[model samples]
Target: MTARGLIFAAPASGTGKTLVTAGLARHLRRRGWRVATAKAGPDFIDPTFHALAAGKPCRNLDVWGMRRATLAGLIGELEAHADFVLCEGVMGLFDGTGPGAEAGSTAELALMTGWPVVLVVDARGQGASVAALLKGFAGHRPSVPLAAVIFNRVSGNRHAALLADATARHLPSLVCLGSLPADPGLALPSRHLGLVPASENRDAEAVIEHCAARIGTSVDVERLLRVALGSTLSAAGKAAPLAPLGERIAVARDEAFCFAYPTLLEGWRSQGAEVTFFSPLANEPPGADADAVYLPGGYPELWPDRLASAQVFMTGIRRAASEGAAIYGECGGYMVLGEALIVGEGQICPMAGLLPLVTSFAERRLCLGYRRATLRVDTNLGAAG
Candidate 1:
């Protein structure tokens, strides 16, 4: 049977969409359903929580960065493996990279996959006014499927009743799943990037369980399942997004290097590449026989002391580089490959010295968004532009 899917979106960010999505995924998984979760943008942190909750790796669906075929292939793969798929949207339901551009928005994903959206509205402040908000979202893009609504941070039964009555009166077509109460304990802690990586959170599983219990009790799980629609995507004859680095690739995997995209690795495997993982924080090095090494992005600055003291890991990577193994580093990984890293209080931390570069995190400067650059010369990434 084709897998049914739902897009858990919100009017804006911080509307408890991540917790709700994770909670619903866990709730369904506990009930004997094979639940698969995905984040609907370029997010590494949220997917970690979803993976923890769903007991599987969460793939990212980036409409802007990924081609249509790649997106279809991923959704197809998810459908083939799981009975149900839940996608957590990024930011607001309609918010994207630019004004009126649907490229990176949740609405775009919903429309593309023909998946019904379960709008999670934060009902903390107003009651009847929410009806107007719902109406605007529903009527904004007539093509996007807005199947149901779920009230979050609801005050009490009276508040829920007020919202429900307002919805029934103003928009009789939209379905109200249920309301989750305002519980401060349900909120996840955040850092500069976003929520702290699930691996770093000691009570990650407990937090997921708490969310699952709350959602299972509050939301109408049966109706929510019914509201999910099957994906309209077909992945027949779709090509992999990019070529693998080498036949055998060794990847850095630890708290500091946790921002690797699962889809990219999965694509590499699909293209007949062998991938292995090692932890630099644990003083582990890449496999000796690895033809290529990948150091992904993460909070390397946070563990500069541990990384700097990992002599074994440093020596191993240097050996690999000298032996002509393709070494690729992105963001935090690039920082580790530098000559030194200036972290907290301008402390100099010795790095792998693979690159004549130094990165400083002493004063944070947030540079976010998509970037496009043409390669100047032939390298591991691609040929010259």
Candidate 2:
């Protein structure tokens, strides 16, 4: 089942979306149904929290960051595992990045997937005007279903009743899922972007448990799940992977280097690579029996101390490369292969003693995009040209 139905939203940031979606996922999971959680944009942090809440990895449906055909195939794969999916929209429901790229916008995804909207509005200041807001958002695009409205930060029963009455008049058929109180405590921690990465927060597990339990108790889980169960999910294309580079490739998958695209790994496997995984932060080295090694990108900045101290992992990678194993590194992985990395807090630490160059966070100035780069050396990834 492809994610049959999902949530389209507004550009309202800090609206407790994390709690609401986490709670929704948690609620669905408790009912013995598998839930696949998705974030609408290029957000890696939110998905980790969703996975923690639902005990399954959350998939991203960013049109800008993925190939349309690849997106369809992965969605199909997840549909088989998830009874229904809870997709949380990024900043407002319409804002997206890049020039001439409305593809990544939540509105576009809603239209493409034919999923309905569950607009989460901060209804504190709006009394009768809430009706007008709902009307505008509801009528923006016709085929995009306006499934329900959930008022967040309502002050009291009277406030909730007032908003509900106005909303009913504007859109009589629309359901108000429920009102969430302005609980200052419901707010989760955030960093430079949005929510802090799940790995950095020590109390993250406890927080997810609380969110799941609360969402399960308060939200109308059964009905929402029923609606999700009714949606259709299918793949957009067939997949036939190319031949693998070698017999075995041990990939680095700890907190520091965990950024492989799902399809790429699946592609490698399909081609005949006996892929294996080991953690770098845990000090596990490349598997002794492996023919090659891979290091992807992640928060190598956060764990400079850990990565610097990861002697065995560093040694294993270098040893494999020295032995002419087809080793490779992506962005963060590329940084890790260098001599040193300067952490965000202005601490310089040594990394894997491979390349003689030092990488500094000071050099980070938004190098992210769907890049097309030419290879300069032969590696497990591809050929040198």
Top model number, lDDT: 1
Distance (Å) between predicted and true CA of 213, model 2? 4.6
Give the RMSD in angstroms, all C-alphas superposed, for model 2: 3.7
Model 2 lDDT tens row, 1-385: 3445567375477777766787777766777777877788666777777777778777777767666665666667667677777788887666656565555777777776666778888877878888888887777666666678778888888888898899888788777766777765566788655677677677777766666665555556555544553333345654434446568989888777766655467788877789999999999988887887788877788788888897888888888888878667777888888889986766889887677778887656765445557879865556897
Regions of candidate 1 where Cα sits further than 4 Å from its true position: 235-241
Per-residue C-alpha lDDT of model 1 across residues 1-385, encoded as one tens digit per residue: 7799999999998899999999888888998999999999888999999999999999999888888888888898888899999999989999888767777899999988999999999999989999999999999988999989999999999999999999889989899989999987688889978899888888778878898999888888888888888998745435365889999999999899999987789879988999999999999999999999999999898999999999999999999999999999998999999999998789999999999998988877756677688999898789999
RMSD of each: 2.0, 3.7
TM-score, candidate number 2:
0.81
Give the Å error, residue 271, model 1: 3.7
Q: Against the true structure, candidate 1 has what lDDT?
A: 0.90
Off by over 4 Å in 2: 1-3, 124-126, 131-136, 139-143, 199-206, 216-235, 239-246, 258-271, 309-311, 344-347, 353-358, 367-385
